[model samples]
Target: MLPRYFYNFSTFMSMFPHNYLIYGADVSIVGATALIIFVLTYFKKWKWLWDNWITTVDHKRIGIMYILAAFAMFFRGGTDGLLMRTQLALPNLHFLSAQHYDEIFTTHGTIMILFMAMPMLIGLINVAVPLQIGARDVAFPYLNAISFWTFFFGAMLFNISFVFGGSPDAGWTSYAPLSELQFDPGPGENYYLLGLQLAGIGTIATGVNFLVTILKMRAPGMTLMKMPQFTWATLITSIIIIFAFPVLTVALALLTIDRLAGAHFFTIAAGGMPMMWVNLFWIWGHPEVYIVILPAFGILSDVISTFSGKKIFGYTAMVVSLAAIAALSFTVWVHHFFTMGAGAAVNSFFGVSTMLIAIPTGVKIFNWLFTMYRGRIRFTTPMLWALAFIPTFVVGGMTGVMLAVAPADYQYHNSYFLVSHFHYVLIGGTVFGAFAGIYYWWPKMFGHKLNERLGRWHVGTFVLFFNMTFFPMYIVGLMGMTRRMYTYPSGLGWTALNLIETIGAFGQGASMMIMAVNIVRSIKFGERDVTGDIWDGRTLEWSTTSPAAEYNFSVLPQVTSVDEWWEEKKRGVVRPDHATFKPIHMPNNSGWPFLIGLSFFIAGFGLVFNWWLSAIVGALGIITFLFLRSFDYNTDHYIPVDEVKRVEAAAGR
Candidate 1:
């Protein structure tokens, strides 16, 4: 009874599977969506949302939106993980088909890295960096909005494949030959290429935006050496993003051409080399690791020093180590495919380059340790996460070093051991650090603190369940169990370890639920942070009011030393008089950024299904918006001095 167009779409049936599990998912999604719609409608917040959130380009608001999206994606990715673990919990389990498993794993990796980790860190950067550096806002407010919306829409396009077409099953890496049109020949892979392409464009813009912001916008008298550690981390990470993301762009473009235009850029039959894809991928991939992590490193430095009641030890060395790590990240990409027969000479060079990174990393670890030694350490939730990171990351780092050995990697390559090591590094290093930053800065972002007891519970359970989940992967991995297997026979001695990992996975899920509850409960009843300096903080951000004014600083701060706010506190330095207040010029919000993102999403969806007409419409819309933005001269306004004074007075400054 279906139309001819419906039958023409080969993968449409896969989207609506006959399985009961997918039916449950469908019902849950519908119910949740309806509930959200009902609440928004009943509250009459549509216009409020449109005017204040969707059209606004305030860095802090944009940052909050990014974090919200990241958290949502984390749930989706985490659920995918739990489902995969459930399937593997017992031998011969048919909870998921092999094909479904492939799709789930692919989405899991892609979502966690691109949608969850990257956005969470970048969100924190946006929320805190401008305030720390005493800048009113990023250099290009509109461009910043563009970055966020494009990333949002791109993620939307990628996620919808699960229900609209079919999910990408080529792994997050999307290795060529397997990812080629001749092999995949579906809308799913096209979604992967175009979705990442859209998001990657936004990422590159963010790097440029922040790079210019930090280099040009710091407070007066704040030299490069005098900047806060998180700001420095943002700076270095921006450099890595600028240099590294272009390679990814090119690789994705080449693959897109191969898939859509009959090009053979990554195809073997037409003289295309598949390994070139791997080389290009890792060229971006290895540095991509640092992109998410360097910011966390910056966060830990600030948090560690703040809670320890001491200045960070070896500040110069820490900066040197950060830069060293960023520079070395590019040289070690070949270690990812060391077993690919790139010859011993090539492998040796990359392996050594990989291990060389450990020196700077170890220096950072020791610096954190030394900073904590003999200090009045406060065991706040954020500080606790920081402390837990040291030992967990150490295990991850040692395992990484072991994997870096070219000859030794042959045994561990593609095993559960490798899975364990990857999770330990990413979850231990990046996730732990993100949690710390969130807890440390929650008050600054929201004008209230998350409940301390609930936060402690969240951190405790997360760290415990996290270890229980991945540590055993090492043991079973060495016992010859491989990664990405949906089911295994019982006699292989892997069932017990798999079951243990499954239980831990669910516990981790519960921990995330605890965090969700903590956030929701704290929003209404949490302790208010009226003083802004709730942590007795060190940076310029603490000098501003909680949830900072629209213009971050009423007057640009004059910084004279590292931890300028702390120094000001020591001297009992009063803020400048309101008599000094001046009109502040701020960028007017525009809807073009949102429209542009929508256009990209439309084009991406069209391209996924090879619908050229829709793609052309989206491309034209993008051009139209850009043209409009160019002619719009009314893009800024000034807040009078009285408004600034009123805002300051309301904060009781």
Candidate 2:
């Protein structure tokens, strides 16, 4: 009984079977949405939300929004993980159907990597980078807003696929031949393509934005070498993004043409080369591994040094190794597919290049150890995460080396061993580092310290359960449990290990719940950070107020050395006088970015269903907004000195 304009709405609805789980989820989603809308309306806060949040161009506020969205995605992704574990808890379990399993895994990987991890790290970069470098804001404030909204909308498009159409079941990579219309024949894969394309555009813009910000906007006398380690990490990560994301964009665009326009770019029935998709994906994908982890590296460095009460040991070597890793990251993409008969010479070359990454990585590990050797160590929660990263990442790195051997990889490729190594590195390294950074910087972001006792419990359970969950996967992987299998027969000897892993998975989920409780509880009951420098921090971010002002600094700092703020503290230096304050020019907020993101979402959704009319309308909306923005000359204003003085006086600065 659907209308013609429904456009396969019946097909979409039929994809979901009539089941209590689906019904319960539907009810939950509806109730949550209604509750949120009612609360916002009842509080009469829609105007406040629109003015200060939706249309604001402040980097700090935008950063907070990104983190909030990331946390939400994390919950979704984590639930997907738990469901997968529940299905696999015992051999021959039917908790999830094969189709359902594939969709869950696909969404889990995409959401965690693209939506959760990237945004969380980028959010931190946005909130902290300009302050660390003493800039009023990023190089392009308006573009920065566009980056966040595009990412936000893109994530939304990907997430809604499960409920609207079917979710992408071709795996997170969406490899060719399988992902082609001849096989998938649904809107799910299209969601992946367009969603990633939109987010990828935003990611590339973010790279360009931060690159220019770091290079052009540092305080006086802050040379590249004098910058904080985290700033250096941001610079390098941005460069990787600039070079890496375009390949993904091109690959997604080609695949979209194959699906929507019936092209033969990656189709098997024509003059298409399917391997090209794999190559292009890994070319970007390998660098992407570095893209997420490198910032974590930076966060750990800053945290280790701060809690250790010392300058980061071997600073020059750390910078050199980071650059070395970035260069080598581009050269090792071939290692991911050495089993594809690329010849021994090709495999050997890539294998060697891959192992070489371990060298620089080892150098950095040693630097962390040396930094902590003789210093007064603070075993705070952030410090604990940083300290835990050392041993955990070493385990990940060693296993990675094992997988790098091309001859040995034939046995390990696509096996649980590979799965083990991947999670070990990602969770142990990147996820751990993110927690460290969040805890370290929470006060600066929120004007309050998370309860230390609760923080300890959070980190303790997380690290313990994290190890429990992922370590047993190595054993099951060795027992020949290939990933992506929805079910396995009994008597495979995987029952015990799988059961252990499921228990551990739930344990990790419990830890996440604890952390969530800590965050919510700390918001109201947490101790206020009266001092801007809560951790006796070493960076310029701590030089400003706990939750920095609209314009971060009253008088922009003048840098002289590495860890300039710390050095100033040692020398008994004082901040500049209020008499020296000047009128601060800042970018005006714009709604164009928000509107453009909406336009992209609309166009993307239309293209997902091959509805050209909707697509064209959305495209025109985008063009119209861009044209309007190009002619808008009144885009900036200035904060008067008197207003600045009044703000500072309130803060007791």
Candidate 3:
């Protein structure tokens, strides 16, 4: 049987004459573009932007760009969430048609996970990790530039779907039979597959890049075990990315061939098994959850220890926990579909593996608590986020454990209850952790502290409404509300809760806007940190100047302990001698990465509409650029001693 949403790939609904939603989107896009153009024209800063930012290979600058882009995607995805809320707020609400609703949610999930969360984390990593480990930059600065630009263009290609082509209506997973060309006959699914493929390529490169960086680039005497928790988190995350992302690459490639070439790899006919796609996706997907979460765990560990004025209690155990989680993450993919007739033996094995993860996780929690035990704990905004994450994430984990029970999962499968549980885990873990890191490292990134008063307000409002928004989902889900239904009839007793959820959604949106306002306000008025160690931080990053110089260190600090900088501060020691400084060799700026990203994007756009000629031209451009890069050997330049001294002196070093 054909799926409910099946349609031809070439279908384009030309009903825009009367569609308010399409018109609204069109007006918004136009207005936003006009505003951008007007601002750029008035400021005449495009040259400045291009010279410094667009082509720069600096890790810190690249990281900031990632954050900026991620926030924009967040807004886009969040709006989609609000639209869904609006539709479900009342019974039979026609705020969106069924097809439109499916597209919105699909885009929301994809954007939040791929464009928003992953980039945000990568950006933060690019910003802080090199500094934290006392490295000048990532293992491959040019490759880092390529990674960022490719991701940027990939995100743009995906975002343009609603305007230029039809939006994808399949779920973010885009399960096989439904995602096949017959059911999803549009450029939308193609965009999803290819955009992610392009972005995933960059991500895999990033994983390899950082894996080498973290492994080989630490300052002298900084052993693997003595690295900061966040660095350790990043290291593990990079490893997970390397091991797990390739599965996605292969899976997406197979699906793309299946769709475009009429291959039956995942189709029900011709020996194709749809279950293989599920297995492959979650094999990558489950670790992806950890890929995002383990970093947060690392961030939380740092926040807890810093605010409590204590060393992390289970330093060894913390490292063990992170590694264990990454290892265990791959073993539990079967739990996602225990009810798909995998039988008791298979399900039980996965169920046990899934449940076992809680041990290391619980160990991490206790370690944080023990760090806080008998210490003076400051309830700073970052610390507050760490504190809130404990119980909330614990609850999320409990619910996850609940779902892992195979027989029980059979009941909860496809229910909003599962949706609520993961949200609790994801929001509680990743979202709060990101905020904590943002607040903790704000000065390091931008040279000014975010306003404390505004930080408090933002956190309070967001946490309150976040709970308000999704907590009731558990209730409604248990009350028989199935997942992904566009509407419910008036008499199911779900109206009141759904209405409350919508109100909460609005509150969350308002809180995010306020956070944005706080960011803008802080740029000029926030506290100035001439001293880099604003938080009395314990890592290598705090050993340098705020808004660190291009060469992160004039000379690398030799680490003697886990919190080496903290130990040095306690001993009243200063920095390494700079009088004998040598010239610093750094990579020169290049525009090749930007051009290559553009070439890939053009090729992808051509492929989206099956424009063979355009695709060919774009492919040729990409090959030409690669050839040009091969012949270019003047990629490095030196900062002489005088210039290095000048920059260091200006930072009060």
Best by lDDT: 1
RMSD (Cα, Å) for all candidates, in order, is 1.7, 1.5, 3.3
Every candidate's lDDT: 0.93, 0.92, 0.89
lDDT of 1 by residue, 1-653 (tens): 23533554655655555667666777887899999889889999888888999999999999999999999999999999999999999999999999889989999999999999999999999999999999999999999999999999999999887766778999999999899999997788988888899999889999999999999999899999999999999999999999999999999999999998999988988799999999999999999999988998999999999999999999999999999999999999998899899999999999999999999999999999999999899999999999989899999999999999999999999899999998998999999999999999999999999989989999999999999899999999999999898899999888888999999999999999999998999889989999988999999999999999889999999999999999999999697799999999999999999999999998888788877777888999899999999999999999999999999999987
- Between candidates 2 and 3, the one scoring higher on TM-score is 2
Question: Which is the winner by lDDT between candidate 1 and candidate 3?
Answer: 1
Candidate 2: stretches off by over 4 Å: 1-7
Give one digit per residue, the lDDT tens place, for model 3 in 72-112: 99999999999999999999989899998998989998999
Write down the TM-score of every candidate.
0.98, 0.98, 0.97
Candidate 2 local lDDT, 258-375, one digit each (tens): 9999999887677998899999999999999999999999999999999999999999999999999999999999988998898999999999999999999999999999999999
- lDDT, residue 394, model 3: 91
In the predicted model 3, the residue pairs found to clash are 9-185, 9-186
Candidate 1: residue 414 Cα off by (Å): 0.7
